[model samples]
Target: MKNVIEDVTCAGCCCVCDHIQVTTDGQQIIDVQTTCPQGQAWFAQSRQTEKQQPLIKGIDASREAAIARAAGLIQEAQSPLLCGMGQSAVDAQRAAISLADLTGATIDSGASAATRALQQVGEANCTLGEVRSRADLIIYWNAENLRFNAHHQQSLVPPGEPVPRKIVTVGSELPGDSRGVDLSLTVSVEDEFEILWRLRALLKGVALEGTTAGELASLAALMQQSSYIVIFFGPASPDERLFHRKLEALSLLAREIQAERRCHTINVPAAGATKGAEPVLAWQTGYAAAVNFAAGYPRFSPCEYSTVKMLEQGEADLCLLIGEDPLTGLSDQAIQRLQQIPLIHVGPVPLVDLQPEVYIPTGISGIHAAGSLYRFDGTPLPLRALISTQQASEAEILNQIETLLKPVMHIC
Candidate 1:
C-alpha cells in the first residue's frame, strides 16, 4: 500500500502561508512544514482522538442532548448573535448565513470596522502589484511593526532592481524584520499628527509650527523628491478618532501631491489585501448590515451593532462563537461576558473553563478543509484538505442544527 501524506494550508492565521506540507502515516498527520507556531499547534490539536463530552451550562451531556439544548436556546432567545467566521469553510459560512436568515439572528465577523475604514479609501489606494510595479516612496504611518500572524511572509515583498523602494516609517518603532525598506523615519505616536501637519505645511511651502524633529525634515525632503508613493496604515487603536485624523491628513497630502506635482499617492492597510478587494469588497456592500441584523432586515452601525460592545454591555444572552477566539485580544469585561453567556462553541479550540451548550471539534481551516481564501494582494488561492478528523465536520454540524431547526421554524 502506498503511504499517502496529507498536505494542508492555513488561512486562519494572517501570514496566509499556503505551502504547508504534511506527512501522514494513515489518517494522522505525522509531520508538518512551512507553517508557523500557531499553524503547527492548530494541526497538532486535530490529531487527538478523545471523544469530546458535549456540555450545557457546565454539565456534561451526550452530543444529541447538547445539540437539542443549543437549538432550544436559539428558539427561546429574542435575539441571537453569531460571531466569528474567518476560519470557517465557505460552505459553513454560507450555512451560518442561512441559519441567521432562518432565525432572526445577528452574524458578524472579526476586523469588520478596519475593513470598512479601508473601503472608504477605495480608488484612493494601491494594490500590491501597483506598489511593486511603480511606487518609489513608501510611507508606513503607524505600520512599522509587520508581525506575520502565520509564518515568514518576508519573501512576498522582494527588493526592487537598481535600488529597493524607499521606506518612510512614521511610528514608535521601526521593524527590523522587513528586509527591503530603504529609509525609516521613526516618530512618537503622540506627535504623529503634528508631524503630518508639518508635512502639509512643507508641501505647500508655508512653514510655521517652529520647525519639526530633524528626522521629520529628512522625511519631508524624501516625500518632495519621490515620483510615486504608497502610505500603509495600521488599524486605529482605542483613541480611534485621533488616529483617523492623522490618516485624513495623509489622504489630503496625497491629493495635494497628485494635483500639484502630478505625483501618485495611495493608502493601504497593514495586513492582507489593499482596499475595495475581496473580503473588504464584501464588507463595503450590504454584507455587514445584512449580517448584523437579528430582525431579518439589514442594519448598519459599528457603534450600535458591534458584537464586542454588545457583549460588554451584557446584551446578548446566547452567543454562537465561530471562527476566532475572543479571549485573545478582547477586553477583560468582554471576555467575562463570553464566560457568562450560554456559548455554543463550534471550532477547533475546546473550551476548558466555560462548558459550551454545544461543543464541536472541527478541522483546521485551509489545512484540513479545502476552500478559497484571499491573499494580501486580492489573489484567490485554492486550498486542499490535508487530513480529516473523526469529530463532525463543520458542514455536518451545521446541517444537523438546520435539521433540528425545521420543527421550530415557525416559533419565532
Candidate 2:
C-alpha cells in the first residue's frame, strides 16, 4: 500500500523547501511532488540501495569498531581538523563543534567562499517571505545564471499577484530566460563597482557626467519608483580577493539605497548544509565560519582558520569530515593536500578517487532522517522522514564518535 506524505521538507539545497509531497510504499519512497528538479533528485537518491557501510582502513567493520578506530585517529593525532558541517543536521553540527572543542581541533564548514565574502562586508538582508511578498523591484546583480532556483524565480513575481514585481539583471551576460527578467543591463564584471557607485550617487541626486550615466540614471529611476527593492548577488568569482572587494561595494550600495527606500540585499550562497552551519557556528562560537577552537576558545580568522588553508599548511594531520562530499567545492590544491592526511568521512556518499581511511555511511537529513535545517534566510524548518533506513543519521554517528572519544581522552 502506498501512502501520501505532504509538506515534506527537502534537504536538497540551502532553500530547505518544506512544501514537498512524497508518495511512499511503507518501506520506500515511490514518488516526490511539488519540488524542483534538485529536490526530486535528492528524494529519489535517498531510496537507492547503494548504501555504504562502516570501514576501517578500507576493510569492512562493525559500527562500534569503526567508531573506536575513528576515535583512535583523533586521540593519536597531534592536530585534528573537523569540517564539512554544511550538509549535516544542526544537532550534528553541534556535536561536531563539541568534538572539535574537546579534541582542540580547527573547525570550518568548507563551504566558506560565500560566508567569507559576507563576513568581510556585512549584509542587509531579509527573509524569502519578505522578498516574495514585499519586494517590487528585484535586481539580480552579477548573478545572471549562477544562483536562484525555480522556487526563487517563481516567488520573485508570484502568479496571480496584485502588484507586478519588475526584475532586472546587471552583469556581463543576461540570464538565459526572458520570463524571469524584465530588464537586462550589459555591464562588465570589471565595471560592476563603478556601476554600483554611480547608482548610489544618482540616488543622492548627484549629476551624471560619465558615459555610464544614462544606464545608472535609468536603474536609479526604477529604484526610486518601486516601494521595495531586493538585490541578489552570488560571490563566486575566479579571484577570491577581488570577490571580497566587490561584495563590500555591493553591501555599501545596499546600505546607501536603504537611506531612501526599503532595500534588502541577499547573498545567494552555494547550496547544501552551509545555511545550517552558519547560524549554529555564530551562536556557539561568536563567529560565523572558518573558526579554530584549538586555543581553548573560538578564534575567527577566515584566511588562517579556513579548512583548505589549514590542510595546505599541514597544520592538521587528521580530518573528521561530516555529511559533505569533500571533492565537490574543494580546490585542486586542497584536494591534493587532503589526500596526504588521514580522513574519517561520515556521510551517505563516499569519495570516488581519494578514499578516506574511515568511511561511515549515514542517512541524508530531511529524507531518511528527521532534523532541523535552516533556510537561506536563516529560518529554521523542521524536516520529516519519508522512509526508514538502517543507516544512522549524521547526528547519531557524530554523537557515537564523540561518546567513544571521551574514554580515549581520559586514557590519554
**Which candidate leads in TM-score?**
2
Write one digit per residue (lDDT tens) for candidate 2, span 202-259.
Answer: 8889898877778778888898999889888754554354566677777888888888
**Candidate 2: residue 188 Cα off by (Å):** 4.0
Q: Give the runs in model 1 whose Cα sits over 4 Å from its true position.
A: 1-8, 35-39, 48-53, 58-62, 115-123, 126-130, 144-153, 157-163, 175-181, 193-201, 208-213, 238-291
lDDT (tens digit, per residue) of candidate 1 on 1-412? 2244434455644435555677776567777775366667766765553345556665677767777777888877777777665556556666676676677776665445543444354235545556666667777667544333324324335466632458666667766765555566666777777777787777777755443545666777787887777776655554343454565666667777777443443333334321222253253335532245565566655554556666777877788876535333345677788777778877766755556667766665555676665554445566676656555656566667778997788654
lDDT of each: 0.60, 0.77
Root-mean-square deviation of candidate 2: 2.4
Q: Report the lDDT of model 2 for residue 193.
A: 70
